[model samples]
Target: MEQSGNQNITDYDLIKGSIAGDPRIQEILYQRFAPKMYAICLRYAGNNDDAQDLLQEGFIKVFRNLEKFRNEGSFEGWLRRVFVNTSIEHYRRKVHLNSISEKEEVGIEDVSVSVLDQLAERDIVQLVQELSPGYRAVFNLYVIEGYSHKEIGEILGISEGTSKSQLARAKSILQKKVAEHLGVTRK
Candidate 1:
């Protein structure tokens, strides 16, 4: 137990302490990852209140499942997976994807895409937040999390085509919103 200080305590040590049910180490771990994880929660949530709820719920799951961690890959990655899954599951309980549009319009594939270079990260995230829940989920899963359409289909219980269609619609919707923000018409 190299408890020199919070900074000196490795993630392995923190996980072990959390597994042993030490409140102090759990607190340390929470303090360490909460900000980043909260950002993720916020992206999936409709607003800050839900983001806070997701954050608290995510930390609870992390501590409860601390013993199951195999220490295989980055612990942060594992923790992120847990948080993403938590958000997905929480969202699943709250909404259905039936309303996600099935229309896949042409021309988006050839779009230059450089318009985003002019925008800040906060601006883009705000645009993503403006999407419907299904569109938002597909966008985050495909773009931010780097999940393949097939994997998204499996996770979200939609068909692969549905996942792809939802992502396309989300992108189309975002493009329109961004164009509106910039006061330019889509080409």
Candidate 2:
């Protein structure tokens, strides 16, 4: 291992050193990715305390499973998948997703792209944070993480229809919240 500082070390070297049980390398890897991972954790967790916990848990998973990475894709991408899965696992443990009835699923309005574009990213994240756990998981998985409904269903142990309904409900709620935040009526 290079005794040089983190600045000069490549990700490859960091991975190798971490796999070899080098505490310094593991810390460096955590420092490099924690901010972005924390953002993801916050998005799924919907609060700082849970986000912090998720971040720590995600890193533990990453370090424990570091040897499984085959280098076929970007390490950052792999790290993101791990954190997202960790967050989803946390959500599953805390919430039992109930499918919305057809009667309740009716009248879900889509938010305009223009309205969403008007808000800052932080504002958007805050709005998303207000979503219920099931809605939030479906929203993040389908919209942010780019998973298909079937994929989300499998990940969250729900039906594809349930995932679709959850996402629709999440969008509807967000639209209403955004409208209220901007002092605009949806009618």
Q: Which candidate comes out best when scored by TM-score?
A: 2
Model 1 per-residue lDDT tens digits across residues 68-177: 89989999999999999999998899989855334543333522345777788888878878888998998899889999999999999998888877777787778788
| Whole-model lDDT, model 1 | 0.85
The prediction achieving the highest lDDT against the true structure is 2
RMSD of each: 3.2, 2.7
Q: Native-vs-model 2 lDDT?
A: 0.88
Q: After superposition, how far is residue 28 of candidate 2 from its true place, in Å?
A: 1.0
What TM value does model 2 have?
A: 0.91
lDDT of all predictions, in order shown? Answer: 0.85, 0.88
Q: Identify the runs in model 1 with alpha carbons over 4 angstroms from their true place.
A: 1-4, 99-113
Candidate 1 residue 21 Cα shift, in angstroms, is 1.9
